[model samples]
Structures are given as C-alpha cells and as structure tokens.
Target chain A: MLSPEGREQIKYKARKFIFGSKDTEGVGKLAAVYLLLISIGFVYLYPVLYMISKSFMNLNDLLDTSINWIPSQMYLENYKQAFQSMDYWKTFRDSVVIAGIPTLINVVICAIVGYGFARYDFKGKKLCIGLLLFSFILPPQATMMPTYVFYTDIGLINSIKAFIVPAILGQGLKSQIFILIFFNFFRQIPKVLIEAAKIDGAGHFKIFRRIALPSAAPAILVVFLFSIVWYWNESYLTQLYVVGAFTSNAGGYHWSSLIVSLKNFENSYNTARSVAGSGMVDINESIEMAGTMLSILPLLIMYLVLQKQFVESVDRTGITGE
Target chain B: MKNGRKTKPGQLERRENAIGYLFILPWLIGILVLVLWPMVQSFGYSLNKIRLLPQGMAKLYVGFENYSQIFLKDPDFIMGLESYLLETLIAVPVIVAFSLIIAMLLNQKISCRGIFRMIFFLPIIIASGPVMQQLADQEAASIPMMNVTMIEQLLDEYLPHVLAVSITSVFSNMITLLWYSGVQILIFLAALQKIDTSLYEAAKMDGGSKWECFWKITLPTVKPMILLNVVYTVIFMSNNEQNALIVLIYDTMLSATGGYGYASAMAWLYSVIESAIVIFFAVLIMGRKDVYERRARKYQRELKREKRLEKKIRKRGERNERNYAKQKAKQQRKGANKKSA
Candidate 1:
C-alpha cells in the first residue's frame, strides 16, 4: 500500500492531467458554444455569400452543376448587363432622394412627437396613445387603396411627394415605432434636469433642442438607419404610386429601378422571348442574383461601416423596455 | 397654503399641456387626415360597388355584398386566411422561444460578442422582399449541407401528416426563420440585461440550481417582454407581403374585374381576422389575474397593518397626555390642603 503523501501526489497528477490545471472543462464549454455560434453565423451569411459568388458567374458557369462557391471564371458581363438594364446611376440617385428625405423628416418629427408624449400630461393623453397603438396595429394594406385614391386625387401620385408628404406629417412607414423609441428614451431623461432648465428660463423648444436631442443621439441614429432601410426596401408603396413614371426616358419599357427591376426583368425577359419565337424561357437566376446584390450593396456597405454604432444602438434605444 | 400649492402647479400644468399639444400637433393632423380619414373611406369603399370611368367614379351602395362573396364564393380567400392563421399560430411561439434562447446565449460572457450580434442583426438590414424572394427562388432558405429528404421521410413515417408537414416546413425554412429573429433577439437581450444580477446571486446562495433560478427569477422578470415580443412578431409576420392574406389582397386590388370595393372588403376582413388573432394571444398570455391579484392583496395587507399601527401609537400618546394632566391637578389640590391646615 502507498503512503498518504504518495496517494495525494497520484491524485494531484490525475487532476492535472484531466483539467490541465486551467479549467479545461470551461475551455471545452466555450469551444462548444463558439462552434455553435460560428455555424449559425455561417447559416445567416450563406445567402449573402451565395449572392456575391453567383453574381460574378457567367451563364455556362452558372449552369454547370459541378461548380459551387467559386465560379470557374469571373464574369463582368452580368454586372454590365444589370447596370445597363437597371439604369443604375439614375435609380441610385432616385433611391437616395426617395429614402433619404423621408428618413430625415421622420427622425425630426418622431422625436418631437415622442417628446410630447413622454414629457407632458394633457387631456386625452391616454386616448391619443391608444390611437397611436391602434394605428400601428392596423396594417397599411387596410387603408392602401383609399390613400392611393386620395393621393391620386390630390395629384401627388407619380412623384416623391407622395412619400415625403406623409413623412413630413409623421405618419410614414413604421414612424410610430420611431416615435415610441424616442418616447421611451426621452422618458428616461431625469426630470430634474428639465426642471433646472426651466428654472434657468429656457424655453421648451430650446430645452428640447439642447438637452433632449443631444442625449437621445443613439435612438435617433437607430431610427434614421431603420427608416432609410425601410424606405429603400419599400416596393409596395412605390409600385402603387410610381410604377412607370420614368419609362419614357429609360427605354420603351419601364425604368428598371433597383428592387422593381427584379420583377420587371422577369416580365421583360418573358415578353422578349415570346416575341422572339421561344414559348418556354427559363428565368436567368444568375442575372437575378446579380441585380439583388446590386440592390443591397449600398445597405451592406452602410451596415459594415456603421456596424459598431448599429449594435450599440440596440442597447441604447431601449426598445426592449429595459 | 394648500390652495396656493394647488393653483401654482395647476397653472404650470396647463402651460405644459399647451406646449405638449403644440409639439404633437403635426402628428394629430396626420392621424386625422392620413390614418383616420383613410380608414373611414375604406369602410365606405367596402360598402359600395365602385366603378371607374374616364372622367369620374361611380359608387353604388352594395350593403355587405362584397363580404358575402368573400365568405361564400372565394376559395382563395378562405385558403389564404386559413394558411395565414396557421402560419402565424406556429410561427409566433417558435419565434419568441427561438429568439429568447438566442438572446440568452448571446448574453453569455463570450468572446467576440459584438461580432455575433452584428452577424445576427445583418439580416434585418438587408432582408428586403426582393432579396428574400431571390433566396427562396434559389432554395437557399434551406440548409444546403444537410439532406432534408431523409429527415422528412422519417418524420412522415412517425408523425401524423399535418404535423409532419409543418415540422418539415419549419426545418426547411429554419435559416429564414432565424433571420427573422434578429431584431427579436436584440429586444430580448436588452430585457435580459435589465434583470438585476443580485437576484441570481441570491438564488445561487440559497442553493437553487440554474434551472430553478431561470424558472423562479428569469421567467417572471421577462414575462412582460415576452408579451411585447409576441405582439411585435404577430404584427410583423402578418404585415409581411409574403403572407397569404396580404398577397390575396394585393392580387384582388390588381385584378381588372375585382375593382376597389372587392379589394377593400378583402382588406377589411383580413384586418378583422388579424385583430382577432392578436386579441386572442393578448388575452391568453396577458389575461392571467393571479399574479396581479396576489400583489394587490399584499399591498392591501401592508396598508392595513400600517394604518393599525398608526392608530395604536396615536391612542397611547393621547391616554398618556390625559393621565399626566390629571396627576398634575391632584398634586396641586394636595399642596393647597396642606397650606390651609
């Protein structure tokens, strides 16, 4: 039989071997978690990677089933076709104008409205809040036609004003959410600060501009980014209002704007093929992918550049009511 | 003094109310002109048979004819409504549970946490309808590396047909669903951060296991956020253009024969059904009265005990004061008698 010291030494050696004296179990757990996260991340990123890869592939490479992940040859022709067909420069400008103006308007107006809701007590405040929530719950589709008609009657159709007008009025797409975010944010600002400003004889507007706006920078940024994205991706409203407005300048066909081009391309392809004597035309997936990539390229770049701010903004905006 | 305090604050409150109205005036106008007016007109449109002409529009009072047609004649409407509801019923719980789990994982003190958050949130930025459509067309929503057919076959053999189909659909579109959960996860993570760490520490010191801690502490604390997430998911998923009801409404609006009245009727019906679903879930999750009632009862008991204690102290003080006065009087009388003798 071994002495007590000898047995202790053996046990210590076994412990050292199993745990490496640095908590090998924790390392193992972390490794498993990271592995899971990385795989899920890859799954999240697959479509984007696929889009990027397939956008550069030629027709032959696209049709070749053996080829995956990377194209046999880098093809510039797809992008060239996409750019020409999409009226790339003009539509990009239009997209900026269409999405940018509304974002700016929504940020300012929503902040004001949210501040009002947050800081003030008034008659029928609950009723107003209930109405705001009701508006949010009511789908835009429920009122789309009437609004379309209203805009048409007012000669606002086929123009950016159709979008800008509502935005100016603080009723743009998901503006209620922005308002709520700002409301939540402004509510969290200590009342004592505002009271001090009041005692100093600062006007309400001055206090808001100086104190509230500066402090709610993160929420404002979040709302701005979200508004830009929503407006950029807004096909339904654009389709309802301005479908064929600029077709005369672009070509005999409708102007192939970024998002609308995807749908239009299929229709144009079908018609062209039918006119040229082919009854069955397989939709070209590669060109479609290329167009989609171009559409989201600006957004992806924006995300990459503002990634830190975007992530931090989620915490600061208090959307989860923390 | 009371009147002075009340009047001073009341004047300030009135002034503040005016400022508040001034700030919200634009939104109020927007609600009236853009939202409420449009809604009222939509109801009117649904009630009429609208005819478009070169110079003007004509409207004839149809009186619920459009609604009847939707229920009785339109197979597409029925099918779309059914599928939309079923999808929502399955998707809401799955989304809430999935996002909560992801949020918990992301909340862990892990390396490269910011990177993981960015990767998850990237989807919200680029998940436009066209891009999603392209992915769906390419079958990219499914896992490319796994053989789903074998799993589907196994599920089919073991489960009922409807159950198998729903499960398989969820499995195939698992990545897409995960993408949809990006914003939700962020919301949940924010809520999770609000949970005080001391509560967990206390639980652990009391020898509570991790699972018990989650049930007793985490779940209750995050219950309100869970309801918020459910509401958000329902509204978002149903509003999506990919939803069958929205698609049906869009198609009806564009159809040459359907006209504005029929489309309006369809939209109104869809909204009603959507509202019904929302109310049902709200009541199911938020209607429980036990937690609230218990808290109220506790508050009442505490208030009653405080009042009782206050009364007892006041009575004792009053009795002591009276006895001291009587003893002083008795001493004065004894002094007067001694002096006279």
Candidate 2:
C-alpha cells in the first residue's frame, strides 16, 4: 500500500539504524547517559538545593505552598540572625584552632610512624601494625568514657589539649587510617631509589626526608585534607568535652553550636507558645535553614575549591587497595 | 674476616632497628598511654559500679552484674541491639551494591563526569553531625516519592508481612541510605579505574559480549575492592553517632540514675557485636577463590620455568667455549714443538 518514495525512505532509514552510520547510535547513547546522570545528580543535590532555596525565602514565601524552588524576595535578615547567634568570626577562629593544630600534628606524626612501618623491619613490627589496625576498628564510643575519665584526671578536660596531646602522639581523629595511607604511599616508593640514595651515603633520616617524603607529596596532601575535614566535622567529642565550658553569651562556639542553637530556639518557642496559649512558634523556618546553611558553608566552600584535588587524592592514595 | 663482615651487617641491622623504633616512638607512646590503657580501663569499668561524687569517685566491684542487667532486665537495650544489627545486616549489602553501580556508571567515558561525581560526593563533605541532624529535623532527608501513601498502601495490600514492612521502611529512609554511599562510590571508582583497558579489548576480540566482559574481567578485578567496601561500610555505618546503640550508650551515660558501669557494659557489648558482624562479612565475602591470585601464581610459575631454561642454555654455551679453548691450546703447543725440531 506504500508509495514508491515512502518505501525508498523506509529502506534507507532501516539501513542507517542497522549499520549505525553517521554515528547516530553514539549520539543517542550519549543523550541517554546524560539524561540518566542529570536525573541522579538532581536527587543527590536536592537537600542542598532545598537548603539554599529555603534559606533565602522570607516567612511568607516559605509558607507559601506554591513557592518551591525560588523565593519571591531575597531575604538577608536570616543570614544576619544566624551570623549573630553563631558569633561567626570568633567561632570560625576557634574552629580553625581546634581543627587545624591537631591536623598538622597528626599528619607529621602519622607520616613518621607510617614511614617506619613501611621501610624498616624490626622486632614486634607485625604486632604494632596489628594494634594500629585494631585501634581503628574499635569504635571510639567504646573508649569514650574511660578517655573522658582519664582526661579529667589529668586536668586536660575542657581544653584543646585533649585533642592536641593525642594528635602529637599520633592517636588523633582517625590517625590510624592516616598512618595506613602514609604506609601505603611510602611502600610504593621505588626500592632502587632508596638503594641509590644509600650508596650515595644518605642515612635513614636523610633518605626519608629527601626521598620518601618528596615522593609521597600527593598522599600527604590527601591525608592532610582528610584529617582537616574529619577534625573539623568532629562534633561528638567536642560536645562531650567542651559543652560545659562555653555559654551562649560567652561567644565561644563549637561546630556543634548550630545544633545547640536550634535546640535552644525550639525550647524558647515552646515556652512562648505556652505563655501565649497558641500552637505557633515565632521562629521562622527560613531562619533555621539559614543557620544550617551557615554551619556547613565553610566546608562547602572548601570542597568546591579543592574538589579536583580531593577526587584525585582518592585515586592516588590507594586507599581502596588498587 | 668472615665473622667481621657478618658482625658489621648485624650491627647495621641493629642500628636500623633503633632508627625505626625512634621514628615510631610517638605512636608507641600514644598507643600505650591513650589506646591500651583506656581499653583496659574500659574493660575494668564494665565489671564495676562507678559513682561520681563531689569529693572523689567510688567504685564497687559488681562482678558482671552490669552485663546481667543488660541481658536479663533491660528491654530497651536488647531492642536497640536487635534493631542495630538488623539495620546493619540489611544496609551494608544494599549500600555496597548501590555504590558499585554508581561507581561503574561514573567510570564510563561520559560528559560532565566531574560534575556528577562532585554532586554525589558533596553530601559526605557537608553532612557533618550538626548539618545532618538539622536536615533530618527539617524533614529534608526524606524522599517525597517514597512518602506517597498510595505506594505504601499497595505494598501493604500485596506483599507478604515481613517483606512489605522491610521494603516500606527502606524506601521511607532511602535518602539517608543513599547519602551513606558517597565514600563507598569513591572507593569503588578508584578500584574500577585501576582495571586495565586491554583486558576488555582482548575479551571483545575473543567475541565476548559486554556482559561477559563485565562478569569475567571487571567483576573479578574489583572483587577485593568489593570486600573492602563491605568492611568499610559495616564499620562506618555502625560507628556513626546516629546508631541506635551509640545513642543508647549516650542516653544511659547522661541519665541521672544510670550508672557508669552499665553504660560501659553496654558499650563493650556493642563493640563485641560490631566485631562479630565485621568478622562475619569478611569471612563470607573473602572466602572465595581469588582469580587474580590464581593468575599471579600461574604467571610466576611460567617466569620461573623460563628463567631456568635460559640458565641451562647459558651453562651449555659456557661448556662449549671451554672445550674449544682447550683444543686450540693443544694445537698451538704442537705447532711450537714442530718449529723447535
């Protein structure tokens, strides 16, 4: 029943589809993949997008059922309140001190210990390595009480010494994993290079300093970033150790202060509701969202700037035992 | 002289040992003072009744009474343990498999791969304790798709009892579960990239399809990584602050009437269960015959055989040269004697 021109066109299209001429199949596949990626990317980014959008909405816009993605107006007051409540500048300084000092100490100590484990053979080395891994496997909660008691006994509680002392000794936040990373990196250094250095009269310290350390730069950076992030995000220990030391009025803040502030806001709202004989809380949702956003803003910026290196670090660290 | 040479290297070895110990001295001290001592103390604390006082601490030896209370008396403790174990058992495999799939997808040559990776990994960087808590408080961590009551109603009407409940619960918290997979995906991606492309090409040339290549080459190549991911996921999930067991321990510790001994006992019990789970997964996943190891052994054997054959050929050639030299020497001596005559 087809016309001659229509039959010719159908035959030509069939041939193109079967042979995949003109790279049509490739383009179609690429389009399909892009579609899949974007959809999943949207899912992964939904919470953060929600945070940002909700943080920018005013009370009326936030409560508006139709407004979802963007706000009617850009509200800056929420940021102002979050900043004031968090004592932004002072807390930022304290966070840097708390997360930074330990990171530096931890990296150096872990690198030295890892170098020893990797490059040298000594009595009980196997046992030491076993203990290192065992410590990592054991949950910190298991030892939390005793460590607390010990720190109190030594009068190191409520102070940064609690973090620094352990870091100096290479037992800081996930230091075992850092040591293992360094161990893997040091082990990958070419034996021939070390042999050549030895023949050139380089001693153990000199070889480690001038050869192994230089070659392990990528691993060092990776561990440094991981250590910093871990220490920065560590709230459980901070809450347990330093909560009593700082009051809201004192302007001293842990990274966990955001949670405390939210809790306080809820408590104050409940009290107000009871006093007013109403079910409403005065604090708006946008302000709370703004506080949450502010809390993670520094980390988000850090990740954005160092994302390439962070991703590359995972590939280079051999943490997955590649 | 032989003894002297041997003693010199022995001395050098001792020196090296000294240097190694020196390098690890800080870690050694840390292990002794921070890790080992606290672990011992934790064990001791679990067996006693500890009371904090205004003046000093009072400790009464309870002799496993605390442990008995947890098992024989406290329903909450047992329930927490059961739920924690069940969640871990279900979540570990699901998270691992999900991350593996995501990693495979990301590993493909595609446009905007970096942006995709960044989006997936961004949650891990920013989902610190406070941030995650805040998000959960705001109900932002829930999946709207899963929250549709119609699907739940259908599941309840059609599926069996346990399957229906488990599926519903998993879907309800799907967002949090997905968030947990960021680090696992990165690890798996690294493992995926380590696989050689030539193997895939060879498989293709042998007329193997993509599915066969994936099963025969890619899966086997990343098997060890799968085990690693399983272990990592187990430990990471179990140790998080949101875990039921950890929350229980914190609550018990903070309660006015709850004793430190009881909390310590709970913590120890949790640790034991965690170790058991880790060991179970490790044994189950790692007990298979490793294809890479078999290939490596075969390659080593072939190399040894080739080396032995080469050595034999060189030995025969050297013997032939010696024989020729002796014959030439005899001929030259005879010629010299003839000239003398």
Candidate 3:
C-alpha cells in the first residue's frame, strides 16, 4: 500500500526514533540515574561496612560517640573478644553438625525426589508432590509446637536429630523446591538421548545417577545453595529445641548456638549497664554491634564467593529472562 | 486415556518404582516420622488443650472452642492478622518497585557493574544470623540514641495513634528492610539480562524515546518476571518473623486465650488471604492480552512518525548552519584582501 519513497521515509523515521538523541540528551539522563544508583548503593552497603569497621575497634573505641568512619587505632580486641567470649570453635562445630548434616541430607534427598518427579510417571506421584507442597506452605512456627512434643516423646529432643530429621524427610527443603525449574529442565532433555541410553539396557537408576543428576547439576547446585543458606540461617526451630542445650553452659562459651548466644549477649549487655549512675553507661550498643559483626562475617564471605553460581543458576532457571 | 491403558506399569516398572521409593527413603522416613506424624499429632493437640506439668495434668478436648476463642474472644488475633496483612501488602510493592529500578540500573554496561551488583546482593547473604542481630541492635539503639523523643513530642502534640503507630514503625523499620531488597534485586537483574538488546534497537528505529522504550518494550518483556517477583515478595514478606507474626504467635501461645490449635487456624487463615491476594493481582494483570498489544502498537506508530520528522529537521538545520559558516569565512577573506590592496 506504500510507495518506495513512503517506505524509505518510514525506514528513516524508525531509525531516527531509536538511535536519535540517545547520545546527547541520554547522557544527562544516564548521569542522573547513575547518581541515584550510587546513592542507593551507598545506603545498601553502609550498614555492613559500618559493622566490619566496628568489628576491628576495641570495646572502648566502639563506645565512643563521635562515630568516625575510620578507627583511631586498629583494635583487634573485638575479634579476639568474639573468639574467646563465644567459644567460636565449639559453636562453629555445632553449627557444622546442625547445619551441615541437614544440608547434606537435603542435597541427596532433594536430588532423588526432584529426579523422580522430573523423569518418572507413577501412581500417587502427583498426589505426593501436591501434599508435600501443601505441608511446605504451612508456616514452620505453627508446626513447631507440635513437632516439639513429637520429638520429646520420641526422645530426639535436645539433639541434632531434631534438626536433621525434618531435613532428611525433605520437610525443611520447602524454600528450595525449584519445582518448576526442575520440571521444565527435565522435560527439555532430548527424548532421543534418554531413549538411546535406555536402548543400551541402562537401568533408570544408572541413567539418573550418570545422566540426569549430572545434567541437573546446575539446578542442583542452585538448590544446594538455597538449602544450605536456609538450614544455616534457621533460628526459630533451633532456638526452641536447643534452649536447654545452652542452659547447661555459662559465660557465653556456648557459642555453638550462635543465635542463642547472641540473645544472651544482648541480655547481658542490657543488664550490665548501671541505670542509676551519674553518667549511665551504654556499652550495650557496642557489644550488640560486636555480636552482630561476628555473626554475619562468615555468611558475607560465603555469599560474596558463591554469587557467581547464584547468578548462573538464575539464568539457567529463566528466573530473570523469560 | 489410550496411553494410560496401553502402557500400564509392569514388573520392571514395579521394580523401578520400588527402587525409586528406596532411593527416596531418606525423605520418606523423615517426613513420616518428623513432619506428617507431627502434623497429625499437632492436630490432635490442637483439638485438646494440654496444660503443662506446672498447670496440672489435665487434657481437655474443647472441640472448636480454641478456634472460637481466637476468632471471637481474643482481641489481638484479628488486629494482628490485619496489621500483618497490611504490612505485607505495603512492603511487597515498595520492595518490588525499588528492586526493579535497581536491577535495571545494575544491568547496564556501566563501570563497576559487578561491584554494584555485589553491593546489592550482599544483603541477601547476611540477611540471617549475625547480620540480622546487628541490624536489629542498631535499630533498637537508634530509638534512644537518635533521640526520637523530639519527634515523638511533635507527634504527640499533633498526629493520631494510627499515624504514629503505622508511620513511625514503618520509618523506623525501613533501615533494616533495605537489606531485604537484595533477593528481589538479584531476580530483577537476572530478568533484565535476559531481555534481547535488539528490542531496544528496534524501538530506537521507531523513534521511541527512552521513556517510550521502557513502557512499550521493556515492561511487557518483563511482565512474567514481575509476577514471579510479586509472588516471591509476598511469600517472603508474609513469612518474615519481624512482621509481627512471631510476636502474635508467641503472645497467643503463651497466653490462655490461644494455643497450638488457634495458631494453626490463624496460619491457615493468613495463608488463604495471602494466596487470594496473589491470585487476584495475577489475574488482574495478565487477564488482558488486547490491552498490552494495543499499547505496544500505539507506541511504535507514534515513535516512528516523530523519529522521521526529527531526522529531517535536524539534517536540514545542520546543512544550513554549515553553509552559513562557509559564506561568513569567504567574505572575511575577501575583506582582508581588499584592505591589503
């Protein structure tokens, strides 16, 4: 319906529209955006940076009111204090036993369960998944009281079993299901490749162990990170079951339960202050800050390192793109 | 139906199924003992109120009394639920919007993009454990150290409790929530990177402004992702203990007004409400393909026309300016020669 001249005009118009004013006017806009972005970056980063700086300051420097961004001196006492005061090794060991065992179980349990859901068709398979998810949606807090009673009756209370049992059963893996991603990825596996493996008389287990698991490695890794982070960070259930575990020890040496120890430190800091003094001491502020600093360092390091796998998984899962 | 009957599971299939079940025994055993059984036992506990050893050994099955007490008698249940929902609704949108904008900026091929991303992503890593403790401590310390008493005096003199309660808490808690945006930011970055750059080029060809490109091309491409973000945000926000669900649960569980049964009812009720909100919004946005198509088409046409006109004008102006400059230079040269002679 259009003439050559008209078509050419249209093409020219389109080209100008897209690439037009992008260089000059766009620079001002981009600069403003960058300024906004940098400000936000500063806001997001300041708290963690402040904590890291504070961690290096001694008890006295931390208590100072001037709030200098840099310390007057590089005080390593806080780090030493955190290590000695919290029984770092015992807590770290306990964290490993409580957080690690479950993470391992989650990876293995989820792999088999996720693989089965992905590659198989059987009776009640759909029902099992639906029910599993239903259980997942129910808040852990609601389930906690009942689980406590159940575990107490079974004599699994106050032990690592209480934590790992749920993880082993895939109960605690709720947050890391990656159900849709797994389903879509499994479906996309070339039917021919699977069939060829089958024709060679390979059992489903062999095929899964050799082929499916390796292929789902990226997704598995994503799930692995998700499960580990979740299990490591859990406090509510851990606090409920492990309250007794801490009362047996004193003087913050029971750092194996970091969450509980942090709470204890907060309580102690608040109680230690003399409210009736001519100048009331507020050392609680610095001690609280110290506890926080000590608590987050490992997680920060872990996240900074594994951010690559996290991003790559995001791409593979189409979480961002489509 | 045909496939179902024709490929009925045989002995090999049965064996494979057995092996599959065996492989998944870890979860099966765990779920049976730890989760399902506990849940069932919880249900039993919920129907009957069990006073601890301190309160004397008496288990009374009050039927639906606990649920009724929570719904009718307990004043905090309704208020707690309402406030929690309201807070979640407020936070989800705010965080999602904030994250989307940041993700877009971070996705650009700018300087220190990876570092910037790290800055944003760092929050998620430290969202739990010591980081949370530190953040909460700082927030608590700020209440007294920052001397909010001055502002509190001002508020007491003027603003009502509703504003004081909602606005003050929201403002005070915001510093801590800045960290919460990390997950959504990562997701948005991932979504932004997936968008084909050629779409922007095409929009450029049509004479679309940056604003127009965002609306016509960028927004639509990322619609599904927006939904995903919303879902994740709602779920996370609802589950956050800081949102007062923890406090409410603790208060109820500690008091005689509510217990395990009541908590379960409240949780189920809250979940339903959350799911409904998610579904409602999802349907509202994705319900109309025609609306999206129309907007895209209108934007493309408008852009194309303006781009053409602007191009023609700019070209002519540039040509005229160049000619004028050339003439002025020639006249100056002539005048210099005449003066020299």
Cα lDDT tens digits, model 2, A107-159, are: 88999999999988888999999999788888887888888888888966766
Query: What's the fnat for candidate 3, on a 0 to 1 scale?
Result: 0.52
Pairs clashing in candidate 2?
A: none
Off by over 4 Å in 2: A1-28, A245-281, B1-11, B147-163, B289-341
Q: Write the per-residue lDDT of candidate 1 for residues A1-322, one digit (tens) a residue.
A: 9999999999888766644443243454567778888898899988888888988888788778899879988887777666555668987877887788889999999999999999999889999999999999999988988998888889677777788889888899899889999999999999999999999999999999999999998999999998998888877677666654332323322322466665566665455545655443354777778778888888889999998877777688987664
Worst 10 residues of 1 chain B by lDDT: B1-10
Ranking by lDDT: 1, 2, 3
Best by lDDT: 1
> With candidate 3 superimposed using the best TM-score fit, by how many Å does residue A63's alpha carbon deviate from the native?
5.8
Ranking the candidates on TM-score from highest down gives 1, 2, 3
- Residues B97-146, candidate 3, lDDT per residue (tens digit)? 88888888887767877778777777666676445656665653122234
What class would a CAPRI assessor give candidate 2's docking? acceptable
Highest-DockQ candidate = 1
Q: Output DockQ, candidate 3.
A: 0.27
Superposed model 1: Cα runs more than 4 Å off? A1-25, A244-257, A268-283, B1-9, B150-160, B288-341
Query: Which of candidates 2 and 3 reaches a greater lDDT?
Result: 2
